[model samples]
Target: MRHLIRRVALAAALLAPAMPALAQETLRLRMNGDVNTLDPISTTNFTVRNAAYLMFDTLYAMDETYQPQPQMAEGTEISEDGLTYTITLRDGLMFHDGSPVTAADAVASLERWGSVDGLGQTLFSKMESIEATDDRTLVIQLAEPWGLVLDALGKISSNVPVIMPAEQAATPASEAVQEPIGSGPYRLVPEEWVPGSVVVFEKFEDYVPRDEPPSMAAGGKIAHFDRVEAIYIPDTATAINALIAGEIDWIEEVPADMLRYFDGVDTAEAVAARQSGNSMQLVVNHLNPPFDDPLVRQALQLAVSQDDFLLAAYGDGEDRYLKCAAVFFCNGPYATDVNTDRVLERDPEAAQALLDEAGYDGTPVMLMHVSDIPTHDAYYAVLKPMLEEAGFTVEVQPSDWATVATRRASKEPVADGGWNVFFTGWGFVDQSNPMTNVYVSGACDDAWFGWACSDELQQLREDFAVAETEEERMALAEEMQRLTHDLVSYVPLGQAFPSVGIATDLEGYIESPVPFFWNLQRVE
Candidate 1:
């Protein structure tokens, strides 16, 4: 598999004859996952969403500072009541298919999202209604005041909401996934999808660039890469080797342990970005025994030493820990203070006392992790011993990533009848609002550990949504975080930092919290 990935990487580096060299410099980014679909609504997986972001445009976008910026919408005006918002559209914007982008298109795009079956329906469900006044103006009426509506739209999941041609969306969902279209820098060429091989994006020269800056952009050139290629190279070792060999210009999701090997390689430049909102933590199923008691959860949190896990997984580097307070480091709105002094110090004796007091006397516990994420395995290897020393029988179950996700979704008890603890990561649309991703009970189907819903937490989250000011919202968020910390639903493990290996020659490549390939543009 490694050898096969190396060959694909090499093939991608050689400029293809089919594309014109004069079109502009094309940067081929070799990634670890498959770019199988152009349909953004089909899946919220980062891999798929990252590609759609390059191929589509949303009403709002996030700038480098993680602030909301306008995209397709020229500007948005909110009424004093804050219930009605009027958005003016940028003029002359056209889809890849050359159709003029209009308020009708925007309304259609939003309506599709409002569908319960849509990938982003959860986000737009709060909208009261959308009305199109003209080709370039949209009016959205909300049920109540939503201060973060623009911020919410700028989310990678929401901002890049795929704009499907009304004609195509009329087709069945199955066909839409196969023949996806959008208004972005590139168009999907289905012929490029070779079985288990490369998926190519052909440049759309007639593509309309947004006249108004996206809500996120202060000011700059729009997307510069004329064409983008996403070649799948599944093996991390081979991906690194390809970068060193100059067979591939860049590789995302670099393995933590192997970062040292490419330290001074002339062809490779190690671009370290704050972890892409990927977080690894231990979740305790509250419905099950042992973990059913908050005290038991607290005992487990105290027993596992975060320092040992960080050292074992990242080998003593500051980059291993995100400075932000959110589960994922770079993107959240609030700045998090890493309580290193408190987090690193393990209190096993105290943990034992807590467990004993809670009536947990050497009860066997199950520790589950997906085998695909190498870091999770490293975490468990270090954590198991700490937990065992605290008088807990630790059983480890490693399985495929998909199977683990299915199990989590089923909300079924682990195969050993029930699991006291499990390891998993939570993915968010953006970093600014960490509360919704981690603590908001119903946001991601269920709580992190499938814990029973809390009425108080739900009320707090609602308060956060309607907060008129940042101070009020943050105060509520802090309270919510404290509640989760006190309840001990899961141990707040360190966030994952994204390590990118790029060719030094590449310029204008800014590292975003949600690492996307389109964010890079060759400067030379």
Candidate 2:
């Protein structure tokens, strides 16, 4: 009888419903690439911006319409002269450590970012200084009237200003890397960051939602996830398998060809739409030979068939290429109706004629590529054959993204005495304001092609910078675009549609031009 009872108890235990693990409540999102650093000032890469969004809040956030909305600041006022601005802070706001966030902290954070030698300082160089008038208010004095200040504050690159604690800023740089403190919705869980594998964040219970409610703020919703676990899944195929097997909740960059595989899965749904702030193009090192010749650059530009590349990289009929009047602002101002088909169509004969005219006698050209970027690899593959067919001796050189970025930053010559041609990509500035991000004389240093800075371009940039009215700014921007189009610094190829995969039951999973994980909320 005791043996019988024991058997019955064991059977009951086996039949009992499986209870969820205590940690299952946390949302885990597998990202395509690893972040270089959590520091906002380090680089302007999207991976860094996505990570920072969870841990930091900017002064002004962007709304669905891409308008600026106040966040930590309760309200702001622009001076009549348009040179000075005053920002009022919200009351009862506190950092993760329960210390009150003050105007002093805001000032210090801006100053720290402005003083740093990286991209943020480059963007915010317009600011003369930020002064704290009181515990609740901060005043920003600009070198000149910048109409795009509000717009700049909402951009993914330099816009999301991560406010660091005063005490933490005072701490030495060596110690600061290990110690990160912020007032965002999530706090860093030091133990969960397993070096190269994953970084986890636990939601801060004390995180105060923006005071005037969601309607008043940009980016309509506050962070809703209780916990966010960002696992670094480097391999594309492994990430797809993990998603299909339900090992991870979501994947950021779903490979273009793998879209159909997820269609039949009942629990998983795919979200693919036109992604904003991204562009793929070929960059020529103007200082280098062959490309240094305008005719050669134009010839190369004419040889590329954007349609073929778009289909291959983004799947057949799944992508679109934009035609802008100026190379600088592809989608914005002074974009008048003109025939771009002549320039973008694959014309090998025309390309060869131009090359011959420029005295190119079959000299070898090096094409630099970052190996990890699948899209870039795909673009390079297409371009190589085209160039070779046009009677140019082309060599393709591949390196890791970091190495490529370092090389580009250092302006070093490519292997075999430097690259004459290379393919690269960039994120879009907010609402097609191309002047600030991609325009030759704008924030982008060294102009991508290592071209000598033109005085004419510099003057044009200055005019756009201080243009009082929208009409004036647009005109200047148009002229700048005309210059870039004529010069062909970098040939504009195409834009990408970000593919996202999410679980079916997940609600509030709206698609954005910029792929951000913050919008996921479970309704079911």
Candidate 3:
């Protein structure tokens, strides 16, 4: 029935006259939510990170083959002891304000970012010092050898290591920058900036792109469009309509079920923009009651069925999603299923027994639901019923993602405006390994959102970090997975490759975990 309605609407929409093109080349994109901040260091929100990809450039980036390549740096030299790393900056790098990018800016930016980012903190923990010896040269002295030095700098997702002006980078990591300044291909139009409605960016004429062909977030970032508009439209149907009518050029996230509507349409095409996709997860507050008990957390994990959540969110396309038990990404190295039978079993009877054994007395679990995003709302729809059937008192707290992002930070009880559980998605890059994966950290008070504390897990991560051989790392990773299941740090629902809809006339789309706008071009 849904397909029939979409088919009819799409046919009629195709018959309508096409809208005239703008005088200036402009790409209007549909954003999931409002981009309140351009400061990448302060938050790990996807929307902001997506926008940041265009507004800022990284020193190093992951290429199509997943190997790190220097972007801003001309080259790097390492000492025989593996302690000293000297990097030379490429020439012609200038910020939006027409100021040349320098090594001092990189040092200050890294210092502030390392204070907050999950991977940065780990990398900085073993660091001795970072200094800019000259205008175009910077040096880093490490206390010990580390494997993920490039990985931490070249990470392609949330809390991205984006460069900024020295003065702006000097701002405390706790506070967001009031203004965003970078040497990327695009510059934010401050005069046209609107928090919720829309945000505008213009191509930087003085910006010099790399000579190499664009690959993932590396190489060239050629901005084909003169202007780019990230327009926020909460309604999925309305956003789709806008795309079909030529009112918008790209829909960042296209629901899996609606991909069929563009089957024979000439105006638009649906592409799997993110090849690796995101790992959808259900995170719980370890500090809160019921969840504070490991038994209760184990029970909740037992109640979940990855298939139910994936089907509800992504429809019946096998290519769209995957059901895997690995805490680290299922496709990557060190992926393991040890002790994941608890998640795969999905026996309601067993879940009830665990809940009973845990002495759960119908404590109302606060599940935060985000209605603005279609996929998230679908996951919420299936999740609430599963909890109820599993012998738990569930209270559905409906709200936007911004509210959930802010509320999840509170360590207070649910009765005191704190939340118990919420669903979020992490890109494969963010979950590929123990060091890069933020949610797996068992740093207690210093851990990411959930605050799950386990010295055993921490020790395993520490061991995994410095493991000399791949076999040793794999063995340590397997142990960590086993401990993760035992501790029920968080539930990994499933993995999904989300589709993006774009105008058929638009070309040069780069397929990556995160979408990029630089090389995209419009065809007449």
Candidate 4:
């Protein structure tokens, strides 16, 4: 009788309903590639910008309309002469470490950022001094009225002016920061990080989000998740399957061929983030050649086709990519088709003749390529045979995009670990105006990665920066675009907006060129 009672009790216990699982407020997502570092100053790519943004706050932020908005700053007072400016920090601000935010931190951050960034360097030339008058105020005295000061500070693109603690901001420009501690809403959980696997972030309880509403990178940034885990699933098929199978929450990239998979799924939805679209450009090292010769550079342009690259990178469709000739972006206000005919034309014989006139040497043209980015891989894959067919000795150097980024910075010759050409892309904000477009700046050693130098181009960009009226600025921009095509510092391949996949449960996600983890309220 006792054995029968025991069996009946065990069966009743097993049949009882399972206890409810603990309620979770975790956000699970993936990136196109692993972020290099959370260090705000060590800005390398778009993925890094989106990640570092949660850890640091800029003094000023740019809105969707490309206007500067006050963020951490109480207000900025500019002199009537536009040569002097005073900035005050918000009250009761503190870093993730519980230390008070100070003006000295802002000064140090700006000085460090100015030393490395192309636009920051430009602004620094005009900045005579950045002095901290008090614990909360910084005074920037300029040599002249620089028009792009706030724009540089508020820039949302790479090499962003992300503020950190004064001690941390003191980190060398050549070095990445050791820790991610800032006054931003999210704090890094170092213990949870698994490099090349997953990284975790937790909301800072002490964070005081601004009372303002959310906009692009500007306004109040309110964190909705208690924890965010950014997982890295390298396999393209596995990531899409994981998203579809409910194993992952979101995907920052969707391989062009798999766009149809998300059509009928009710549990998942794919929406385009960073919808401003990005354009791939060919960046060539001016330090070495056959590419060093202007004639060779121009000759390289004639043999290639943007359509070939675009069709391969994106899916089959004419609407997938725009044949953009403007380096600044075809969609922006600065766009001009002045020398587009030269870009659209494909004449290998004419290209060969130009190469002949330039006295084409058999110098090996090293094309540093990345296999990870589909578009870049597509473009370079097409460019290799095209350049070879054009009678240039081409050596395709295959590397991950991150390594390609590091290698492209070398000043040595290709034989001595330097590269002749590399691939990179930019969205609208980074290229919209002459002020932020470092590729066209022509600052010689001080220019963007490729180090293209032209004094005339420099003068033109500077003139556009200080132009008194829109008409004057537009004229200078048109001239600059025309000059860029002729210079061939970089080839504008094509343009297209890419989409990101997110769970339908995640709502209130804003449409931005840079992804934001704020203002999103979860639903069951």
The Cα RMSD of model 2 versus the native structure comes to 7.5
What C-alpha lDDT, on a 0 to 100 scale, does residue 249 get in candidate 3? 82
Cα lDDT of model 3 by residue, 1-524, tens digit: 44543443333223323312663387878766767788888778888888888889888898998888899988789899898889899989999999999999999999888988878988898899999999899998899998678878888888899999999998987688977898999998877776666777889999988899988989999998888888777777767766776667888788987787777778887788557488888987899988999989999888889999998988778888889878888988878889998887787778899989989988899888899888989989998889889998989888887678667778889999987899888888889878878766788987878888989878888888788998998888888888888888789888898888898888898888888889999887
Question: In candidate 3, which residue ranges exceed 4 Å CA deviation?
Answer: 1-24
Model number with the top lDDT = 3
RMSD per candidate (Å) reads 5.2, 7.5, 4.3, 7.4
Clashes found in each candidate (C-alpha, N, C closer than 3 A)? 15, 3, 0, 0
Model 2 poorest 10 in a row by lDDT: 10-19
Instruction: Work out the TM-score per prediction.
Output: 0.77, 0.80, 0.93, 0.91
| Residues 1-524, model 4: lDDT tens digits | 43443333223222323211332476767776666577756655676677788778889998877788888898899999998899999986889888989999999999988887877877888878999999999999999898778888898887889888878788887688866687888888776666566667778888887788888888888998887767666555666666666556677767576778898898687665446577777777778978889888888788787887778777684555688878678877888888876577777888899999999978988887777666666778888888888788888777776577556667898888888887777887788768778778888887777778889899997787678998998899888888888888887788877767777777878778887888776787
Best by TM-score: 3
Q: In angstroms, what RMSD does candidate 1 have relative to the true structure?
A: 5.2
Per-residue error (Å), model 3, residue 445: 1.7
Residue 408 alpha-carbon offset, candidate 2, angstroms: 3.3
| TM-score, prediction 1 | 0.77
Model 4 stretches with alpha carbons more than 4 Å out: 1-24
